[model samples]
Target: MMTGGPEPDSPDVMSVLELLAVGAPPARFEELLRTARREEAPDSTLAELDQAVRLASRVQALIGHAQQREAGLAALVDTAHDLTLVHGMEALLHEIARRARRLLNFDMAYIGLRAADDEGRASSIRAAEGETTSLSVGLKTFEDSGLGSLVQRSGAPAWSPDYLADRDLPHSPDIDAVVRAEGLHAILAVPLGYGTTVFGTLYGADRKVRHFTPDEISLMRSLGRLAGVAIERARLLEATRAEVTELELDTSRARSSLNVQRRVEAAYIRLIDLVLSGCDPQTLAEAAVKELSGALVVRDCVGRTIVVTGTPPRLTEDDVLRWTYDAHAAGCPVPMPDGGWVAPVTAGGENLGAILLVPDEPLTDGFGVRLLQLTARAVALILLLQRTSTVAHDQIRDELLDELLSDIRTQPRQLIPRARRLGIAIDEPHVMVLARPEGGPEGRAAAWASSYAHRMSGLMRFRDGYVTLLVPSEDPLAAATAVSEELTPLVGHPVTVGAAGPVSGPGRVAQAHREALSCLEALTELGNLGCVATPQQMGFLGVLLSENRGVGEYIRSVIGPVVDYDTQRFTELTRTLDAYFASSSSPTRAASDLHVHPNTVSRRLERIAELLGADWQDPERALEIQLALRLHRTRRTLQHRHAATGAARDAGSPAPRGSGP
Candidate 1:
């Protein structure tokens, strides 16, 4: 309906535009227009004001619609995270349908499962929500061309604006009758299944004729996919429960004997208590040792002894391996070469380790053997829990490292929170250690590195034949030595380690890696493959081998603090060091050379120690410090001579003879 009014000019339109900008309501706008009319304002002004109000109203409606959709999407995300805690299939399906209806504001939503034999041709509604009539539930359809059937066949969403009036797609008479009776229209059906296996369809319908937006259709499809995954998980959980129940029944029947039953019951009770108390491998081994009449020994999968009690016969690697194979094959305790019994610690057919029970005498009784086997199972469980925890922790650490190392552009501030979650204070001074085991399997070394890093509350990454760890230690050389010492025996071979940095922040991790690599390369070049060293320990050779040729950095790293202190206070520590070194370690001679008392030279040396470290005079550190002092003095002398020559030349005088090119 058009209202007669004069055409709008620029001035009248601008006034109405200002009203619209403030979001003035139509009522206020109408009042303004009425006042304008009373004031004998032009018809164009009234018309323009009316138009602005309409525009503002439409914008508000659109904004409100957008916010509602955003809230619905957020709810969908929450539902996905919540689905993991659901247990029953029926309850989960019902929840899925209800959420879909609520999120999409549908009149009704239902889930339909296709018949197993008919293959998308026949389906019956399994769950429904927001249904006005009970007929929607228990509803069955057999038509091949129905909405649900089509969605099931194609594994895509199908919709019709008017359910009964749409002729492009065929519909079953019974289904149409229910829809007509319910006055339903604007129906949508999306297939629910994982990947290529289409098992069912989810349908959303509205009573009034409406067009579902693309987002609404996509939301329904996402719900369908999530439902499919949830269904799969539920089915797997049920299967696992059934298997556990059956295994328990079989175990009970196997332990039917009175003595065996008593032992089994007591052992199982103790095992549960051990697990609930968060017992470690050593504790579990100790419990087994207490039960045994003689001695017990536990070793990890790699033949590393975890716990030993009493005077158990020493077993060589071959002995352990052979006995382990026999015990695993026999599925119980087997006799050891020393007349003892050994049981394989295993979980889900994976070998975790072995437990050896060396009783005082040979026991032919089944009870002793069964007890040994139970002990092994407990050990397996403990080890499995430890392995799982270590794996999860390592995964998080590796993720952080991946972000740091792979992407050099990643900000350290962004990774601080993730590092803190793993108990790594990334801002604290830390050293980077790079280790390469000279022998043993790389995988074993990597596993050990991961476990070691976790135990030390550090992060590690195994890449390109090297295991890199970022440990919170200020002394890189000591850290490297410790890693090599600890890993060498465990790996059954030499492990070369190189280290760099007491870097204060994680941002310099990449730089530390490069420096550490240079140390490693320098060691390898000198045939020092089974040793530990830092770039500072490598001396001037480190600068030559390093890619960055960090000679100035190396010199500064050793003597920069001393030089800075001397510059700030105008001290003679640098001269004292050179004189002390030149006088063949004689403080009297250095004092005589400096023409000062020996006591003054001693005080300067002590200050030098304070500036450097207490270990500044250690053989290795002293060598580095002496090298830094010589290089620092030489560079200074060259600078002074060059400056003198430049000044002489600038004064129109001949340069000094030795300084000439």
Candidate 2:
């Protein structure tokens, strides 16, 4: 504000000095030079002014460069912070691209991650920013692209002033087209990582031709390094999570296996306990069914049900048959329609039986199948044990029965006590039944008879090649008939049985046995195979065939003369007598029965009377004669049958030496 002559510090000069101190732009300093010339300043003053302007210009340039560097530093710091906050790779890459453009002031900036395919020959742009054109975020660069290829191959930062004209790196026509379309001339690219394991490339481009400075290239490399660290960290974290999940799954499976094994062990212990306790087959099966919460059925070798337990599904005979076949064939537990299982029970490689288990719920693992198999094994053992015990009991009973049927030397008092010990009530009214199997082995018939006798609470033995059973019954004939019917299927053929007495005491057993034997023989001689009979069933034939009957004395007392006449003259007087008695003594009926004339019948009867005496026509004598005739006829018939049997044997026998081949 000083006036008059110019002051030591003029306003214009002070303004210029202030601009120089503050390091203003070169243009401001140039204005100061113009002011100094227009005021016609001294040469030394002008020179000082020019020197100050020059110095200020240099200072201004340095300050601008420092400020730009500080701004770039701040942008880099922000990028690092943002990267830390980024969780996703795509987001992190996009943020890097955005920061790069803002810090470098580029026309376009993008990040490309290498494809994971073989050779990593291509890079796909994952993120982009500051694009004037419609920028495709995922633009891909080929193997021949100049910027991406040079950066990846060199594993360092790379750039080109004019990418289209560059010949130092491979050039791609498609990349060039995209670059031209985007109006991009200058490009800088840096590998995302070091060495051969580079993950991707980072790019910055300008629309105008430009020479990328070393500092700018270094900045791009820093961004690339930061992106690489993030990508690697994300991959490691994902891998760790996967490994942890797999470990947890393995631990869970191990625990499930342990639990199943524990349950199976407990089931096995329970089965052993049952066996040790001497529980019967039925009891063991019931326990298994209850523990398994299912239905259980145990069958014998013959397909007969030994034990059935629990609320099982209704099974038909056809279903049982099918299951048996399947179980036997598979030799393991077979799954059924109702979430059940079937297994064969075997011992000594013999199919002892079959077991069916139908659970309330489906078995999820092998534990249920294992349990069923163990149960079947237990059942097999029980069945085998029972069979052994049965054989032992049969042996003991057979011994006692033999002694009881022997000679009277073994007193009834001693026999009774032994029979009592064997669970037989010998003092009770009992019948002696003798069973003869037709066309069946004696051993098989004896064993079957013993089993049958045991079931009926009787005593049985194989004596003199005959299966004899001493049964407690009031009616011997009825008992014999019952046994015959039961033995039909067991023997697999016809069986003839003879029974005697409802004898009151053990002392009468011997007599009863003899009578039963006699009845059996009479049945054979009478051609009544497969028939059951008692001594009383033989009628008058019973007396003739009785063990105590005096056959010759009886015939002599009745038709003695006729028998003597036939013996001496070798005539058929006995046969004529038999015919007369069979026809009720009517001459005409007798002739018809003999196939002769009535007069011939009459003459034969006259001859019979002359030999037997005239009183033979009386009722008492006639009854005797009739009885005697039946005895003679039975004897004759038996002799004829014996002769025929001998003839048959001779016929059936092979011819001695000259037999035909």
**Residue 203 accuracy (lDDT) in model 2:** 88
Instruction: Quote model 2's TM-score.
Output: 0.38
- Residue 277 accuracy (lDDT) in model 1: 70
TM-score per model over all chains: 0.46, 0.38
Which pairs clash inside model 2? none
Lowest-sum lDDT 10-residue window in model 1: 1-10
CA lDDT, every prediction?
0.75, 0.72
Top candidate, metric TM-score = 1
Give the per-residue lDDT digits (tens) of candidate 2, residues 559-587: 78778888899987777777777777778
